[model samples]
Target: MSDIFRYIQKYQNRSLKELPFTHVDALIFAQLSYIDYRTIRNIYAKPKLKQIAHLLDLQEVEAGYLSGKDNRRLLLALAHAKRYQNIQLINETKIINEETCEQFHALTFAYKQMYYIVFEGTDTSILGWKEDLHMLVYPVVPAQQDGVRYLEQMLKHPFKKAIVVGHSKGGSIATYASLHVNKKVQRKIKAIYNFDGPALQSVESLEPIQNRYYKFVTQATFFGLFFENEENYRIVKSNERWLLQHNLYTWMIEDTNFIYLDQLDSRFYQINRKARDALLSLTHQERETFIVSLSEIFDDNQITDVAQLTNSWSQTSIMLLRSLTKVEKEKRDAIMKTVGLVVSEMLRR
Candidate 1:
């Protein structure tokens, strides 16, 4: 299965004007926003992609190390590539809140006289995951609010056209920002690419610019199908299994485009629909209480990332079971049922 890494190798010599920017490029920029720009703070401010790549190379050589699995490496390679070398990064911002469980990052780039606003997805922090849960009931999350402000600020700069793109939670914010921006800003937006991002709880405000939205999801997408999405979406092929398909890196690409699927697998579609219905069945207060309780339980175990919890599955499972015993009976049952359905669906797959 060919991924963005291969896409870069294939089209590295071609500029955006030569081959045109596709969804694959959007995903790359979205993922690139995850890199800790603080490391290369000096040049990273309004630096060209080539300059960012140079800084990354220096960091690798100085440390005498590089992780092949690192997204930064992929981004650096893309930066050095002829296709993206001239892309100019204008601004970047990150806001993190542990108490509110909010994490947001946005990067503005200039390519071929147009602007691209990319949002970073969920990170390893527990707060980042909680923000995803907050979407279940909240009409607009803190991160989404930040995204809108960031876009508005970016529009203050000189630009002829604009595009918004993101993956996972970031994708949700990208859609939110594009829809909520003022009419003057909206006039400049050419497109909004959402890579496996959850849908908004309410999209009435988005109706005006609905035609500008493009959604892409995978076969076994769980997060992408979380809420109501009235717009049509392209289901793309993925190399990973089940929920791992949510990883943008796992999505397959051909040349400059994604390997699009006509539709999701039947079983996976049924499962996703069932999961969405079940989640919507819960009241807002119930969903909030459940997420808070679940987050507290994870905090009690000092588990910051999903990998950490999985690494000590036996211990974490025991801890989770014990913690559930203390919850109020009504809330506990709802939480347990939702969890059981997810586990059963995974096992069935």
Candidate 2:
């Protein structure tokens, strides 16, 4: 919990909001900070609804609402969509059709672009509650279905080569899409970079498509590198401490853009297999209960409430470390850990 406060204060200029932080607020704020600023502006400025939809592949809303919300949800939605653009070209081409050439040229001019998209919910709401709810609707299902849908629809550009990348759940979708796109599309992809997204539920279903994915995780990252079947992708070591392991930090920059730790080997994929087996042993009901419990913490008055609720790693961690001695460990930990963090940070402020 203290880690969250330290991050907020250390990056105050990067902080999007000034009020006291809550559990959800901390998470959303960290996410926004990780993103690059120009990408955020492009999401809002892009006039085409389909273009906006393609830019934000995670959340699904009808194209008609592109101009309606003028709020953070729409803004965050756009920000998420823009993270996947990694198109690169060696030679300038006027040979392609004008529209296609224009699209290719747009991404070719940049090695990597940073974006910051934020959605500050109404005071009555916590940060990212609506967005997180949307992600959970298909809990326990393989993400490839949606992943393929997103890739096919959004990544229609034809260029010499491109690298697609993302963090957390974004990584999951990127891996799924690259492995499953048609062979022609697959060849166009030079590489894929995923930062500690969770593994798939059924490896047998994914065996055919696993070779193309490149995954990175810290030694201590609890969620992405582990869970479901352990990640079977290339895993990278990070210099940051365990608590700051997720994508908000750790990924370094090379030639101005982010540099993914370049290590993918046979051992990494094997670990992902082990992780999958361990996660499958848990019952389906057990998983649903866990999400429900995490959601309850967000039902708090603001996103930062979790910081004030407890002084520990998280409800999920307490359950695992304590051997789940009690049935209610997850819920109790969520409330307590959140409260502890938020209160301490408020006092410090």
| Each prediction's TM-score versus the true structure | 0.87, 0.45
lDDT string for model 1 (71-172, tens) is 656766876799988888887788888877789888888876699889988876778878887888788889998888888888876656889999888888
State the lDDT of candidate 2 residue by residue for 199-303, as single tens digits: 543344554444545555655554575544544554444546443455343433332123344543344345444444443344455544545554444454233
TM-score of 2: 0.45
Model 2 CA deviation exceeding 4 Å by range: 1-33, 36-146, 158-161, 182-184, 205-211, 228-235, 251-282, 293-297, 300-349
How good is model 1 by TM-score?
A: 0.87
RMSD of 1: 3.4
Task: Give the worst 10-residue stretch by lDDT in candidate 2.
Answer: 100-109
lDDT of each: 0.77, 0.39
